[model samples]
Target: MATQNLIPLLIILVSAILACVEAQTSDQTSWAKRNETEKEVITTLQFYFHDVVSGPNPTAIRIAQAASTNASSYLFGALWMIDDPLTVGPGPSSKLIGRARGLYGSVGQTDWGLIMALSYVFTDGIYDGSSFSLLGFNPVMKSGREMAVVGGTGLFRLARGYAIANTYQANANGDAIVGYNVTIVTYV
Candidate 1:
């Protein structure tokens, strides 16, 4: 009888230990050190581009609103919780537009306005520490280009880093010609 009770206690203790270990490991995967920085980056890009997204009725007013809201939430989560983000480089507006345009072009002939609008926000969010894959936590760019990386977003799983822009582009219409080029930098 004592042995049976002791066995159960052992199992509980082992499970508790495993849980603690998992918790600590997750912390190691965090990018909390750059949380504030990521938020600033995301906010600057999101504010401007989200407005652009609103202007174009790619879907409908309600749809656009939902997309905007979702992007905002994703951005918040990316900066607040996500560690690594895919990014390009910050550069001249002309160059950024060029890249953004190129990406849309590659997307196989979609609506130009919608493409550009999405491009602006897409690149912006990426450079702002948005993860391609959201561990147990969801990434902000999940709905956008972040998922576009590597056979779409659902495949890539682990992201323990941040991204920075190498270039940027703004269009004459105050839209993006290319947008922002950024790169992923691992979180340490």
Candidate 2:
């Protein structure tokens, strides 16, 4: 009876040991594979972003805002969800390339700053079906704003880099066209 109990315990112990060994071996194998097959590639891309907030067919819309958001000079606490178009040029009629879809909120009280969480999904050329994530602060009032490129999918897998945005045009209604220069490093 005691031997039967010991048998189960021994089986459990052996199984746990095997699992641990397998996990270690798997980790080592993956590390080796990554070292052998992965090569770091840096790519730079330029594009234009169109943010239309007030038009018949707007691409960006104000989803939420705080009670005092309108009272602030910087429109603090205003949150927007956007699906803006990315084009080859600043003009609306420029060649469509991708879309910038995500959320951004005014987080600055004394300045026009936004906390943006966005993904640039490419739909043209070699990058078709690939997308990279951007998450960082955007000081809109500045001449150039830099944001981090955190991660990506498809061809941009394991991507990390930065994006520089410069406002090309802005109107009274808050619609704007911005130019983006992004540099990213990805493991291929």
Candidate 3:
């Protein structure tokens, strides 16, 4: 009788152990790597955000492996379609910003984030009267629509709310942008 009771208890213990082990194993993709196209896109986007969000003189590569998530793959792709998609920095300043302003400012990857980041930096990444006026004047008001109209990318549909929130803020005139996610465009 004791042996039979022990057998059942042992089975239960084994089953519980298996459950715990399985829980520890997740089957998600490692998106931070640059082996594939999508991962590379994410890598570039992360660097851009870290760079111009600071200034023309940022001198650090503080972005980590898990910068963005797998879910943001589409936004990264959209960025690739429009921008240079190069990793040109980790130097004294972010070369990604420099190249865009250098030779490809007109037809390069000018995502709403980049535009707003430019506005944000010009304003010293802080919103005062002079700063607010600059961002408000030539901001990305119909940015999503303009991007779609020009290239017809669906990033605007994929990440609209984030774009609006990141790309603009409220002032007496309207919203001001401290920073914007140039990659994500809006539909309506």
Among the numbered candidates, top TM-score falls to: 2
* Model 1 RMSD, rounded to 1 decimal: 14.6
Reference-based lDDT, residue 77, model 1 = 16
Question: Judged by TM-score relative to the true structure, which candidate is superior, 2 or 3?
Answer: 2
Error of 3 at 23 (Å): 4.9
The TM-score of predicted model 1 comes to: 0.22
C-alpha lDDT score of every prediction, in listed order: 0.28, 0.95, 0.28
Q: Which pairs clash in the backbone of model 2?
A: none
TM-score per prediction, in order, is 0.22, 0.84, 0.22
List the lowest-lDDT window of 10 residues for candidate 2. Answer: 33-42
lDDT of 3 at 156: 20
lDDT of 3 by residue, 118-173 (tens): 22122111111111001111223354322211111222222221222223232432
Error of 3 at 102 (Å): 36
Ranking of predictions according to lDDT: 2, 1, 3
Cα lDDT for residue 140, candidate 3: 33
Off by over 4 Å in 3: 28-37, 40-153, 156-188
Tens-digit lDDT track of model 2 for 1-98:
99989999999999999999999999999999878997889999999999999979889889999999999998999999999999999987999999
List the lowest-lDDT window of 10 residues for candidate 3: 126-135
